[model samples]
Target: MSEIVYGNLLYPQDDTPDETVLGCIRGARDVGVTTFDTADIYGMFRSENLLGRALAGEPREELVLCTKVGMPTAGGPNGRGLSRKHILESVDGSLRRLRVDHIDVYTAHRYDPETPIEEVMWTFAELVRSGKVLYMGMSEWPVESITEASRLAQELHVPLVCHMPRYSMLWRVPESEVFKTCDDLGIGQITYFTLEQGVLTGKYLPGVDWPAGSRGTDLKGGRGPLMRHWLDADDALTRIQRLAPLAEDSGLSLAQLAVAWVLQHPSVAGAVIGASRPEQLHHNAEASGRPLEADLMSRIDQILGGDLIVHSA
Candidate 1:
């Protein structure tokens, strides 16, 4: 799988046309990005539809298509969770939208407290056996839940291959327990929020107004609130800005530096990145295979400081 997976979350934005979004997706593929990640709940299912249209003619065997279920897509009680009915129903909808016979990876978008772990594992196993999904995994699941599911997966013969976690320089909670547990279970991590919602990209400067059209200013769609935790912290912004000089010294953009930092982890199989433009995708793809020296890593740690980073859950 490609280390840089194009994430179709907020892409194909309400304001952006389908042609522009398709162009960006194709541009990512042009830059050697073979893995594309999306979910049924993302963009209320439009993302999967658009991604399906974008990659319709490509050789299916050469690409890795991933999507998630278990998020509420409708108002009814049966509309969500990892129950057999939901998973069984959701997979067919995902297949129809993605225009694919089998998803390379099908993940539980989040842990469902209402469902039994055994049922979840067994349902996923059935999908694998039925050829609707190739592998199974989870995103943002609790550590105990992951361990329990991993155990159940073993008994059910499900191929639980990866864990999707929110990991970045600013958010280091996964390092405390998730990484070790996944590593022990022989599962690789495909991390999201590697750029801290564009904060680590050096676009939001300390003591300065957010750049026009940035996530910080997007009050609609709840993006602004999602980024408020970082945007409201000037000290964190200041520290993030300090990394710019280091990024330049290494001949890398701040976004590339941020993405590379997550990829540095041994357990990280890939980093999912979202981009509105093709050039952004091209720039981030360069972070793959680039190693930051130990000295640089230590310097980054010192600059961000212990208090600003979240090292535990």
Candidate 2:
């Protein structure tokens, strides 16, 4: 990989208990995950508390901790968006919730169209100057919003160093321009959905029963095409099946294949993998150094046929 290791992982804000949450974090670190990605809004701040407990006694210097703001913490008119008050309040709250002195790379969880870019950029600049946050950026932001933010930050002399978005074979919207923009601006791209919510794990074969808790079958409000509502429940099942041979050719598990494929994109800084268990994390860790042959990569592109995903720059 690129000099930077992929340890910054996303921990979903569901009802997972402390034991389960901490177990996963410790499990990740035990297996060499040196960075973690979380947000103030994750799990209604539940995940952060558990994550904070997990890193309580660890050596802080050995890790890169990042958390995000801009989303509502308790859900209210003022509780959400990228207003100066929300950004300032939540950055401190994220620091408190994470139980860390300062966040390594604090990001706007998403863009806030209502807020002025100057206020948002300088708010983080103030955080950095106050030594509360080291660096700042935005995630899941549209290209124009990001461009405007970067421009304002630059004009104000504040550093915006990262851009977080979803990028995978299933969701290639970022490929269009966000990747190129990241390259041009020298901003790091941290991508989530690298496995398409476990869709590319290759276990959801056609006609097979849904595994007990697989995201496709059981994840409530999952972003999947429904057979009843859209097409059949097996939507995209066939397309994924066509991807198997390429994965096998590279000597990788399908999940590894998906993540590795994303890594092939030069603009990607880190692919956030969600681990429900220790063994699953081990599988992801192995993907870090595996190389995808050029022919195998080309084959995957052919399998996922369609017009290329485009995002306005």
Candidate 3:
């Protein structure tokens, strides 16, 4: 398929189309990002509606639509997980908001430990069979869980096609074994956080209030416990400073350089760009076109201290 270019439009709760996103969506369409990533619990189900309205009259066929289910929420008992209730209810709710008959890719937002895998697989298999979801995938899944999921899809005859993982210059954990596993399984790997939530963007310096202008600064659920804007900011700045010359020689911005690094991998199918505004969208789109030189990649590996890969959970 023509290189799948998608954006993670996360609105996790009644978030309005802030001026930035309104312009960003217009810019995305101006460039060539027609596919979008979203989730049921994003903005408490308001994210999809906001996106749906922004993209209201665009031709459905022109867009490759996708969304996710199975994450914690505030609604009710069926508000989370991959139980039959949540999965079925979520798909309908998502469809209603997205205003689409079928989703190109409907992913399990996370592994639902409380529910049986068989139930989740069976319910989703039926959705695919009924023509609601064109294809399916798993996100933030452990390698073993993904293997198990692949096996279940096989026995159930459902096609599990892609994997969404956090992969970037900082989070290279997927490289440990996830990339190889995906390669062996024939599942494409789509990555996000490629810039380590903008740490790799070469923007943050040793002491600048952690660059409050970044999407990473405004992420939902707060930064993870291990990674805060302040604690890691110092090291990130140092790394970027060290890598500046390499990016300079290549004539690319640090953000583009980091993204290009992720795309250089054989296992990466595509990189997901999260945009808070139009210029960022254009900037991200432009990065895909910039070629990552081999020598530059080697330099980055050295500057990042050690392997910048993420460990499998």
RMSD of each: 1.3, 3.1, 2.5
The numbered model that scores best in TM-score is 1
Instruction: Arrange candidates, best lDDT first.
Output: 1, 3, 2
The residue-by-residue lDDT of candidate 3 on 219-278, one tens digit each, is 554355545642464765676678877877787777777777878888887787766667
Total backbone clashes of candidate 1, pairs 3 or more residues apart or in separate chains? 0
Off by over 4 Å in 2: 1-13, 219-235, 307-313
Residue 131 accuracy (lDDT) in model 1: 92
Q: State the local distance difference test value for candidate 2.
A: 0.73
Query: What is the alpha-carbon lDDT of model 1 when measured against the actual structure?
Result: 0.90
Candidate 1, residues 1-313, lDDT tens digits: the string is: 9999999875323556788788889998999999999999887788899999999999998899999999888878799998899989999999999999999999999999999888889889999999989999799999899999989998888999999999999999999899999999998999998887788888988788888888777655536554788888889899898999999999999999999999998999999998878999999999999999999999999999999998876
Kindly give the number of clashing pairs for every candidate.
Answer: 0, 3, 10
Give the Å shift of residue 301 in candidate 3: 0.4
- Taking all chains together, the TM-score of candidate 2 against the true structure is 0.90
Q: Candidate 1, clashing residue pairs?
A: none
